[model samples]
Target: MKRKILLSALLLPAVMAFGQQYGGMWIPTELNEKEMKSLGMKISAKDIFNPDKASIKDAVVQFDGGCTAEVISPKGLLLTNHHCGYDNIQSHSTVENDLLTNGFWAKDMNGELPNPGVTVDFITDIKEVTAQILPGTENLTGAELTKKINENIEAYKKAQKTESYQTISVRSMYYGNKFYAYVIETFKDIRLVGAPPSAIGKYGSDTDNWVWPRHTGDFSMFRIYADKNNKPSEYSKDNIPYTPKHFLPISIKDKKEDDFTFVFGFPGRTTEYLPAIAVEKIMTETDPAMIAVRDVALKTLDEKMRVDPATKIKYASKYARVANYWKKWIGEVEGLKKSNAVEKKKQYEQTLISKNPAIKPTIDGLNQKYNEQAPYNLHKAYYSEVVRNSETLTLAGIYSNYIKAYEEGKMDAKNNEALKARLTEVYKDYDAELDAKVTAKILALYANKTPAQFLPKDFGMLKDANKNLGTIENMSKMSVITGRGNLNGIKTSDLNKLFENPKALVANLKKDPLVEMYGSFKSSYFETTDAKVTALQTDIDALQKKFMAQQMETDKDRKFFPDANSTLRVTYGQVKGSEPRDAVSYGYQTHLAGVMEKYVPGDYEFDVPKKLISLYNSKDYGVYKDKTGDVPVNFTATNHTTGGNSGSPALDAYGNLIGLNFDRQWEGTMSDINYDPKLCRNIMVDTKYILFVIDKYADSKWLLNEMKIVK
Candidate 1:
């Protein structure tokens, strides 16, 4: 027994050391300072995040509510992924001056283009409020407990003292075991400064998106503007560039493999603690269903885009949005299977139950609940994919809400204006002919895949002789949504006329074929599947929370980090590469030479600009060239990141910017569920490459003078 105890104690430290070396999205306040120092972090935890003074956290902001961005200069020069800023860029693009194709560089501050609805939020403070939130709900379970906690949060937010510019938001962590409130300041006026053309910014396009050894210069620049007092305000001509508390200095020093690195940003979501059964469900049923539906949509779009340049421009952003996840899901299924995540999870569960037999019931109950919820989960996935992917159906859903509001006597002038504005935006880049084709294919797939019991009452009417295309096309010709079949359906210009007569409009819309079809699908989902899924999910969540607590209690030696909930986090690791499979090794970085090797003239995905080629031939890389006499495009690191980590800052030992985090290796996409350091590596664009593009490529050297560059 003495020997066994000694051996167990020794093994505990080794296990913790392994965890420290690789996987974890840690909270900045609760950092493992000792381990970080051991891993070569020269700066202290306080230097990274200090609430009382200026620190690194002050420079990082949530870009437009979806991705992360870092301030690079005192004048509020911001850096983020090109894809994060793609929507704004596309918005400013025209057939004559297509910023997406020709790129854009603001020669002076006055030339910077304004983005109307874009905003960036800075997290000023984060404080743990678990003590206040959980005190009154000790005996409560399920909905009652949730209701009381929300009430407590509302009271806490009202009681806290904050500045007029600050807004308070509360988020649950560790599955409700802890809660943190964030004080955020949002800046309304953000403008685009510069971006590389698609040939450079999106070099590989969809083909090399999640792959390593990437040559894409996936970075863009924006600036934040504020009122005269440097406070958050809506856009106006009098506003000036806001001064930031602290900005990251760029490091152009040559880096090597095994160098220490860390990523700081807000990661959207992850399910790292789910049981084996739940992981299996995601791998087998959920991902495959979504993939199949998107496959049809992509094939149709790809064929259409190749034939018509106008269509290509209209659908470029939409295609990227769809293809991004379609490929990610494919890679995730392969990664989960390759990593044997489910089996490993089962073994871990066995150990947990072996350590404390009392928790066996909880684990078993959770697994059973997941098994019962699998079918409903699949139905939900198919429904969401079908509804969201079809533009016509999406518009139908919007009109459905308008009809409901008019019937409920809730429609006002403000709501009518908002509806008109939304419809105009939707129809701007919309193609009814293309949507009709995509809708017919996706609807057919949905009918074939989803179980008959869960389908809508008139689902059969969508299919003719087991082939949905002809029937769907016929409906499209006659329906008012697509405006394709006959001239009787509503046109884009005719929508405003319908809104003039509320009662008649509702009556006509209720009779419209597309609106009726959408209503059937939505009604069936809400009445039959969604309610059951929600009830089971509530029970499952309660059980999972209990299971999480039990695991913590049973394994006192283990260190736990909360799952990402779109909150600020810090994940540290080394700049390294991996052998994802036998006989297939990947390098740590890719150089400019790799770009030339992949270049193809007049190709949509691989075309290189003439000026860039001339510069490359002359070897005029300036100060951005690496020690090896080549410009480093991208590098791989072992940072655990996910969706919202896009455009996060990859920092060096002294907290200087070394690279910009963009994409994860394809195999590592599964890190959202199970993280393996060997298989998971986040891809980043080298800062040197960013500098080269700004100085040599775009000839925007004046903007570089605002930055603090360290050689």
Candidate 2:
């Protein structure tokens, strides 16, 4: 048949290399050991991942579901990026004792500070379950196919013999062509060990984030604790430091260009194989629109933070988290355009379709779906950005829970106790004035920019009020959520009044304009836009799965890798730099002198601690200094990485920890979709710099003695 011939042609090109080398989030179990060895990976695949044996994978962990961390000592002394641990650090900081500004060091085990609700998950097993997950469903399509797959996944998980402390979940890989089950043991009692002040940990702060030739120390320390049995347990006085199955030895040897390197960690998400239409939409519409909204938020937060030290302390983590991705979107859009990614994807699609005209219909459907859903996607983004980013709207969301509980007649002593605890936590860090300003600006933008039909009826009806959402004074007075001022001013008595008489609370909320507006938005979003978006996305996913299956079948020899989905993966490359653009060559490494060069006295982002400055000036790097007689601060490598790889270990050829992966060069953030091996480089804080800060700066020699250090 013509279809058969066309499929064969598609398979021919699919198996051939596209010429770019060594940039993939590879599965540790399925790695091509011979090919990896040829690419300068000196260690065997078994050394990287072996469920039954002690390996590097034993030390890597998912930190608080958002970042990665590695065990550096037998006592489970954990190392992660300062930014990854920023929230925990900020949680412990106050204006009077400002741990964030001045840093903290635990002189001994007893001094380690416990972080409530923080968890570290270690993978105990990963198995390919595609054979079990996809059977009895290959002939099905659309919702039925998804339903069957999910049911199979549930059955698989239910069958696993897991402990109370262990959690197992299944994730689809290669766009649902394969399923992987990961067995994870999560430790709930992760504690902070030490960190440099924000000045050292976040040198150049937002200004130098995601840039190359960097000097940010960007490292923080934590310790995982367990009960005497060395099993997962909550924080307790009797809990002791956990002894990990394996831990990485910190290396003091100098790194050079082309020296073998690799990174292992969980990466959040990637759409590397999206059709050209989706890529175009991201670059042209979605990213720019979201970026604009976040820019407004960042500006407001930054201005307020600069003026008030308490506000700065309160919003530092929030501001940094928001600004990080906002800036990244700007860079991603620019990079996608500069790389001609959309056009390249189009060309690749054309080539594949030309070879296999049988797939033309599938490709057409995918493109049409993307084009149709573009506007809705953008509207959904605007809604989330406006409502979720504004504290007023987010707080309103909480009140909706109260309203729901009232309607369901579920309010009781136990529930009220839980509600009180939630309110207390929310109010502790809540800033009324800052959030009010943000609410005004965010609401105005949403009112003007979001599609009229997508806007809540109440919000849309009031759009004629000078194109603004009215004064904060009027809005707050009408809001039960804001408590006639803001959430912090809300009292226990106020909630008690609501819980005492659910009917009275319902009547009150029904009359409250802000509460009614929140209800309208919530109902409209789920009833209309959310439902529509979900249906369209389901169609898109089905089409994508078809295309992915084809690619997998055809490209049997291409060494295809799965896209990142917050699952553990190994990426290997070398210590290298790039000329991102013409006349802008960057080197592989940076040193203490560069840190001094960037230092600015009394500056928030660039201020160096006087003691650190003195040590740098005296060249007192001690045993941590590289062969160049200068302490290395940070370096770049060609290893492909993304957001969740933050705090992942950058290992040398011999499996020693040499650096901690923290960021990527700004020009290469688009590597998540379009990896150009020459331009894409991961930034890491040199482990030696971490050692210097701990041993020399913090005078934590006792802690250094715990680590297994290598020359």
Please name the candidate that would achieve the greatest TM-score relative to the true structure: 1
**lDDT tens string, model 1, 1-711?**
011111110121211123344488888888767767887899999999999999999999999999999999999999999999999999999999999999999999999989998999999888999998998899999889989999999999999998887899999998998899999999999999999998999998877879766889999999999999999889999999989999999999988766789999999999899999999999999999999889989998999998999999889878988998998998899889998999999998999999999889998999899989989999999999999899889988988999999889888999888988888877778887788788888887887787888889868555542366666666666666555533334465566775666786777678878888899989999987898899899989999889888888898766788999889999988877666766556777788888888888987888999988988999999888887798898988888999899999999999999999999999878999998887889999999999999999999998999999999
Give the clash count for each candidate.
1, 0
List TM-scores for all candidates, in order: 0.91, 0.87
Runs with alpha carbons beyond 4 Å of true place in candidate 2: 1-22, 32-35, 87-99, 113-118, 157-167, 186-191, 225-243, 300-318, 413-441, 451-473, 476-480, 483-506
Q: How accurate locally, in lDDT, is each candidate?
A: 0.87, 0.82
Give the worst 10-residue stretch by lDDT in candidate 1.
1-10
Error of 1 at 547 (Å): 1.4
How many times do residue backbones clash in model 2? 0
lDDT of 2 by residue, 587-651 (tens): 67888887777777887777889999899888887888877788888888888899899999999
